[model samples]
Target: MGEFLMDKVDLDDVLDKFGVFDRYHAVSGIFLVLGMAWNAMWYFNFIFVTEKVEYRCADHLLPNNTSANASTTLWCANPAVCSEWVYDNPDSFVAEFQLACQEWKRTLIGGVQSFGLMLGSFIIGALSDRFGRKTLIVITGVTGAALGLAKSFSTSYWLYFALEFLEAGFGDVTSPLFTLAVEMVATKSRVTYATICNVGFSGGLLVVLIAWLVPYWRHFQRVLYAPGLLFIVYIHVIDESPRWLLSQGKKEEAVHIIRKAANQNKLNIEENLIDMISCEKDEGLSFFTVLGNTLKSKSLLKRFIVCSVCLIACTFASHGLIINSVSLSGNKYTNFALSFGLKLPSSILSGYIIAKFNRRSPLILFFMACAALCIGQPFIPKSKYLLWLLILTYMAGKLTASMCLNTALIYTFELFPTKTRSSMHALCLAISKIGSITATQTPLMMAYWSGLPTAMFGGVALVAGLATLLVPDTGNKNLPNTVCEAEALEYSDRIKK
Candidate 1:
């Protein structure tokens, strides 16, 4: 009787009975999304830290006049070599360190920070898959924040930058939390869970922008880094993912966690049914096996490349549109907040649309619509003549791009099997960072052509939309536990010769 019951029970079937958003998941998700809101501050902190500082030459770069001061000296047609600079904002790092002529140093700090974040994604994602999600989340989340707070005391530029690198390379809690969120819910409810977490991400960005009112960098750092420590409490509150536990062949432990959820949801699950549950094991902890399977499978490899291209476009456009959104003539802080406001709303709408229809069509539509909006940007005349029109058009692009990114993440997450899902998603994120890095330098393209940045964004988005057609739609599929199961994710569209 036990053997018969064990053979008949499936994990998803048991979980679906708990209902997608049960009280257990609700309690777990509260901690996870709050962690997201806290993590978002550090992730986008560079936008505040590297803000442009107003400066002027102290000496020879200006015309020789005894009356010349900081403001009057700025009119110099050519900003030649300068031994020193005067600044308006004394608390700014640029002013504090006297980084008058070395603009690249300022920019390099941002680049180094990004590079560290990229590396963190790879290391933490791999570790989470092997070590367990709750452990890494507590360790990395607190450690990263502590390192970031430590940077507040650095007296030298290089020392401050070193802390920046270390803090970022320490990894984030949100990645593993996101992995846990989808796995905790039913297939039909995955989008709902993912978007709610994403809203928390945007919420963090909004929270950090308020730091513009903090007055001092150290004070903001303290405020930003302090909340992250609260995540350490997750160790006691949250347990390991039952799906991951089952994959690792820890059936008794997985069943214990399931029982907790059943009790919280008040579901009268059968004791015999629970007793007969079995765990599913996949290819070992080796990430190589996952990659090897992809390399060998023709359809998966094709789908892999297609998802990569879409991710590239999503990351690139999302970053580029953010910079453009703030470049409009207005209060940079207000503009930044309003620009990203659509992020939260669009994610909710996109999740509904994807859950209702299918993944491929909405993704294709969002990407294509973003392409159209961005492509027409240069022809829209100057902000002075039609300010609302300019903001309206580009903000629409930002909205669509935000939708594209959220959907792309869910699509990629659904594409791979559960065992390697976090790492595979991380790899895609790491690859997509190339586009992110490139987008940062895109303003340089304007030296060659005034409209080049907008043009490039449109081009990549168009390519991503077109490339998406080659891949299968994952809307109708369940989370695949094995590579073979994932191969049929084309909504049962089997490979044909």
Candidate 2:
């Protein structure tokens, strides 16, 4: 009986018996993806709303009698030509605020958002682990929606900037939502759910592309807010993660949810099946305890360092390439759309690669591919054909970076135990946000030399790719539910070696 109990006493077996990808799983997965799509709208909305449209100095600044040609010549002569501005698009923040020559301020808008994301990752990460995943989702979701609406009505750049920061803090819900999604599903289905969430995120980019038809930034911003309303419905339909429930000693609630899931899939679970629902009785394990344990474990610490480095490199290269692509010799809308569209296929491919191969190879391969492209981008000669070539190369680099990002999402989710999953996920994202903050400065780096930022992106990615070898591959393995289980897996591997 002890042997039989041991054979059937894991989360994976329980999930298998419960119907891993059943009707309930399908419904929950759909809602999770939609939630992800809503988060993505605000995350990428800045790209569209703050887009640099064509502008020139206001006519009054040119001179009273200035001909169009003389006005143009005089405008070129004035260093402070942005005293007043006429923009091709009357609604963009850049045009309204006369930010033509003040490119750094424009960059700040995105930079501040990234900063908020960084802050949110740490704050909300801890809060989610403490309060529960669903609670934080509702809190952050409502707050993010409110701020996004308020930001649309800002009367000044500073007001908009302040709101952007707050909205980002509230709006960066993807990491926690990701943790929730992974925990809700079966172990074998984690990658599929994560990739589906990514697909929804890419769908948010598509929503932005479609919203571009609205023709005014404020109107576009308002449209972005419309999706957040769906969160209200989410409050009614979504279930809290049962794994998280079990971990918190809410066994009754966990069993109820699992039975409901089984019923939704048309399976009648045995009444005594709850007896097999085994988990470590970690009633008071807090984030600090996990951190203390992690700090003491050489393997855990090494895994943290390697994973963090990989995340930083991927974030820097990906965001820098996408943000800098606006300066390339193509229509900004087309470039942005194409760049964002590439994520769809890359996300699908990432799911397949993770399912079929070890996690380390894909990260190493994609990061190195991106590095090669970034390093080669600056060497291409300036010509009409070559310009397109460079753009395609850059797009390929972005695609590879997307794959790295998708892999990292699953890799990190699987790397840690359930007790510390949310916090560790948040920490990884916070590190990536720092990399994003750095990527925001790519424009500043470009001023010194256009190739400099790409070179930096390449160098970091190369180091990250090589460093990936140090982290263990977690493909096709049961996820750890406690720190001891996580460490045991690592130690057992070492013992075999």
Candidate 3:
């Protein structure tokens, strides 16, 4: 009787009967998927506004003997000092602040936003796991939207930077929303669900369109962030995750959601069986205790460490490639768009490969392919004929790296258990911040050697890929809800409590 209390016993068992893709799931999914896309853009929207733009000293004299002011259309990158500057994109943060010589400050913009994301995920994600994903999602969602919208009106760069930090640290919903999105679907569709959430012309690609449609930074931000204001209404619309309810020992709430879902799906659930659900909340285990258990297990701990290495490498490669894409010989806007825009296809292919094949093999192959292309990029001769080759090779690197990054994300989701899944995912993301921060300085690395950043991306990716063999494969496995279940992931390591 204790073991058969509906979801408390086995959520998948109940979810199987309730119907994973019924009307209830479909309605809830639309809101959650959109939520995922919205959350994706806010983190990197700074990329478009702070992108490197054409600028030259504003105090200089033009060839016609006319003094250059902010309105001067002519530009030159002379190696001379000046008090003022002219930027091609007057609305860009780079242009508005005259960061022509103070390039480090411009780079700091990305660093600050990445830091906010890292800190927010580590701190707020834990809070969500403890309280509830739904509550935290609404609070963070509203707060994030407000801060981001306020940033559009800021005149001072420092004020803008502060707003960026505040918005990201308080508003990051990826971790919570990610778990929620995946949990709403069944295990068989988890990969497909993850793929669609990102590949559906999500944040990176959308920003390109938004930036093109409204080239000015302030106005663009207003247009981009205003829709996020609707997140406040999610409190009434989005349902609390059923798995989270069961984990917290809220049997009644879980039953309620299940019953509602069943009725919506036109399925019949035995009310008497639901009434028989009598059990404690997994003995009221604290999050730390369960997490500690995973760390204690030799199998789980080994996997965690290896997964961290892979994630760090993935972020480094992904960020470095996209940030450096604009410098390639082509239209800057087109290059930037292709850098992320092409992920739509690569994501679909990666999802299929990882699903049809095993997770480990495709990861190894993708990372190796990306590493080879990136490492070879600098060797391409600088010439009109080979410029196409250079861009093609670079874009290829971006494509494979994107695929590898996606694989790393889904792989991490499978390796951990539900007891501390979000917490663990947040930790991995937080740990990977080192790569993101380092990636910001890639543009600066070109001074020492044009190929230094590219080579660096390849080297790290190479090592991470080779190391993937050390971690166990989790293809076509059920989502584990306990440390014991996670330890039993591989048959050889399975232990009976």
Candidate 4:
């Protein structure tokens, strides 16, 4: 009888013993998708900057009213007038541009605001682990939407900057969505489902494409307003993650949330099922202790450096193409369309292909392609056809790097312990922003010196290629659950061989 029972208990049987019932609640899934979609608006910030800055600066190059025919002359207004005067007086234009740049440097360094968002993610993730996922989701959604709306209407630069920080801080509600969704679902389906955010992120690029087609800043603002407001309404219907509650030893609340989910799916959960179970204990350390632990973790430190290097490289390459979409000299719309167009299919293919192949292979190949593009870009002369070809190459490189970004996130999250995972991930995000800030400023400065953008993008691609070698392959193996476990893998045959 004992032998027969041992044969009957396979891994599948074990999982089924602990699996969730009524897994397909329509309301819960919809709310999750909507909330994630709302969080995707940050990707659209590139589009916002492109349109707003372009609209403000386009007439800066135009001839003044005094120089043109009276009938043809149109008196400039607001930003348009300030641009005209600056353009007409060549000597003073640089000073004015410098002043404007100084005044709004923080806005340009928008990636710096990512630090605050990381703080919020750390705080909210702990709160979710302690309190409830559903509560934080609703609170974060409403708060983020309110802040986003306030940012849209802020009257002063400092006020607007403050609100932007608030928006970043609260909008991180989606950061925990991965952990939450994976925990709530059955283990078998969790891998594929949690990764749906990759496709959603690509879909967000399409959103930016459509949003960019809006000619002015105000019209674009009006369009984004709806998504922000809608998110708050949808948060009410989502259920909390039962896995989180169970981990925190809140068995009753876990069972309550699970039963509610089951009820919504028209199934019944056993009342005493949760009471019959036991789970491993979690220390639930404070944020500072987590940070200290992460700093002391040699393997985590190595992985963090790898991620940071790749992030800086990827940001430099991707934004080299993204930042130029609003400039006066190039075909802005065509450039944006081509870059964003490549990203959608590229991102989807990456997720699918990476699942089947060794992770390092794709990254290495993409970075090499980027390197080749950089070496060849300088030779291509400035013409519409050549420009389009360059744009296409740039898009291809960005698509590949974007895939690396997705893979890095998955890799980093798995490489750390649960206690310090959020903080470590947040630090990596902040580091990645430093890369983006450099990318934002580098091309404009390069263009000022050389009067060529092709060279700038090419140089960026080269740097990104060098960074690829620093990233470790994180595929086909189980991630270590503790610092000690992770340290053992460092000298494993995979690396030694």
Full-model lDDT for every candidate: 0.78, 0.79, 0.79, 0.55
Each candidate's clash count: 0, 0, 1, 0
- What tens digits encode model 3's per-residue C-alpha lDDT throughout 449-481? 999999899999999999898776778778887
Model 1, range 1-497, lDDT digits (tens) per residue?
86654665667777778665678888887888788877877876766776667776666445554444544435444556556667768788778876765666766666677677677878878777887778888888889878988988889899998898888778567678888888877777788889888888777665545577785777777877877777778888988888888888888888999999888888889887776666776556666666676778887788778888888899788877775555667987777787777788888999999999879899999999999998987678775879788778878888998999999999988988888888888777767776777776665566587667877888899999999989888885779987888887764855532
> Any runs in candidate 3 off by more than 4 Å, and if so which?
1-9, 18-21, 64-81, 200-203, 270-294, 491-497
C-alpha root-mean-square deviation, candidate 1: 3.1
Any idea what lDDT model 1 has?
Answer: 0.78
Assess every candidate by TM-score. Answer: 0.92, 0.92, 0.89, 0.75
Weakest 10 consecutive residues of candidate 2 by summed lDDT:
61-70
lDDT of 3: 0.79
Global lDDT for candidate 2? 0.79
Return the lDDT, model 1, position 36: 80
Encode model 4's per-residue lDDT on 1-497: one tens digit a residue. 86444432221222233333235543455556566665665544634532322112434444554443332234322334544332222322123233332424523535445545645666775665555567666777767767766755655555656776777777666656655554555534333444565445544454565465764444455465446665555545566665555556666776676556555566554444434544444678766677677678766677777766666666656655566544524666666655655555655666566666646667666666666665565565668767766555656655665665665556555556544554566566656665566655554465364435545555655665565565455555454445776666555635656
